[model samples]
Target: MATGTGIGTEIQISDSSDEQVILKTKMIKLDTHNWVQWSCQMENYLTARRYDDLFMPPSEETKRSSKFRQKNSSALALLWGCVSSELEGVLLDNKTSFYDTWEVLGNICGKNSIVTICETFYELISLKYKPESSLQAHIHSFQKLCARYNSITSDKVLKATFPPKLLAATFIRSLNGDKELTGLVQTLYDIKPFTPAAVISRVAIEHSRRQPNEQALFAGSSNKSMQKTKWDEQKQRNKGQRSGKKYDKPGPSDKNDSDKRMDNIKKMLEKLQASMKPQSAHLTTESNIKTVVPTLMLS
Candidate 1:
């Protein structure tokens, strides 16, 4: 008897053993084109829970009965939890019994209306490959759409059919938006026995082949980006060192400046020594003349 309050609806019912049976709505949620499978699963599940009686219309006497009302309430809870949000809204708006709600669902999805057929046709033609999902899933979805469209159109006044060639073509067209799968389209068309099965098989093969290549490409690009980032960081560090406030160690520019200063000092020392040599020579000449004059006087 446990239940959830809001959109994440859960209804628990007791089985013969009095164990709680949790309803998983996702497993039986009615999709746009899955009424056949959905109805089957729903019926099977409800039958297991002994609530399949709700599938039939309630008589006037049973409608007023307390036991029938209780069963109907549980059936309604299960039905509401099993349907998608869109269909849940339709059920809510009707505000009817379980049998009436079941009837409404059958009318909308069980029997193919003109509007439903046209919508399915439009969706099949306009479907594109979404990168979020795999190529295989895209192809499978296309196949399902084709099946639904054909099934619905089979009983129409002007019966429509999707041939194998058209299905293959439509699938290929759907894959056009995906860069990786687009290459296989022409190859699929060129192969003999152009059919959906052939195209799907080829696509699956190509997808498996390209998976490793894609991962390798991603790894290579990531490595290159990492290297570039490290290089940039090193460059920035060198720039900061060159412009650092503290000059504790001499850099290339500092070493160059020190060499220039040493060269200038050497040149200045050489010039001073050259000037002192000439003055010494002149003094030595003057002393020799004095000595010569004195020696001549003594003789």
Candidate 2:
């Protein structure tokens, strides 16, 4: 089997006999969310089936060959089968040849243009782990962005500018807000050969380890909220009771004190009147004695 396509491009032709690569498992269906994975898987499928040459532009020498036509047809059918129903429109007018369909798919879903590469690079670096979402989901999203960045960048002249180790570091950096996961990932990075798979494995173990603690914290917060509500209700009830009966108004003890003060003033006034009457009676008796003595002497 010719290893090279004689076009300065290196091709890997399988040593296995040219047997029909029957579909053993379902191929990954293409969707907006999974374009990176889909393209990667599709390329693997193409290479394995020895039909990857259909992806390249047909040279003048082989463009008219019947062998190219047969292989191109098979590759085109494979692409059409992999596309999801919603994205079927992308293939409608673009399916002129295998190369055309592949390029169109790359331009649309793969974002093969320079502008899209920049956008994808920015997205990959800025991808952060959301605390509200599951750890596994965040990791999955991180992996997708890394894969997407590589896929888009691979189309450029400077292919795969960022290495896998660099991508792993970027992923670890994305976990800056999470101390435990960051530490765990960093330790794994320092301790062993740091790959994306290793980071994911260690992070997953740490996440599972922390699950019970997270649940306990959530339950504790719920209990605190319930207690606060109960306290607020009790306070409102006490306030309502105090409002119903005015606590500041005079009570029975106050009224009794006022009555006792009035009785003491009345008793003091009676005593003063009795003493003045005695003084007046004594003065009158003294005058009568003087007059009686003078009359007896005259008799």
The numbered model that scores best in TM-score is: 1
- What overall lDDT, based on C-alpha atoms, would model 1 receive against the true structure? 0.70
Each model's C-alpha lDDT? Answer: 0.70, 0.66
Q: Which ten residues in a row have the lowest lDDT in candidate 2?
A: 1-10
Reference-based lDDT, residue 258, model 1: 49
TM-score on alpha carbons, each prediction: 0.58, 0.46
Residue range with the least summed lDDT across 10 consecutive positions in model 1? 290-299
- 130-205 per-residue lDDT for model 2 (tens digits): 6556887888888777767776677557465876687778888878776555556558668457777777788888
User: Clashes per prediction?
Assistant: 0, 0
Off by over 4 Å in 2: 1-21, 31-35, 84-96, 130-141, 158-173, 176-299
lDDT of 1 at 165: 90
Tens-place lDDT per residue, model 1, 172-257, is: 88877766655666687896698888878888897788689889999999999999998896666557657853333445556675
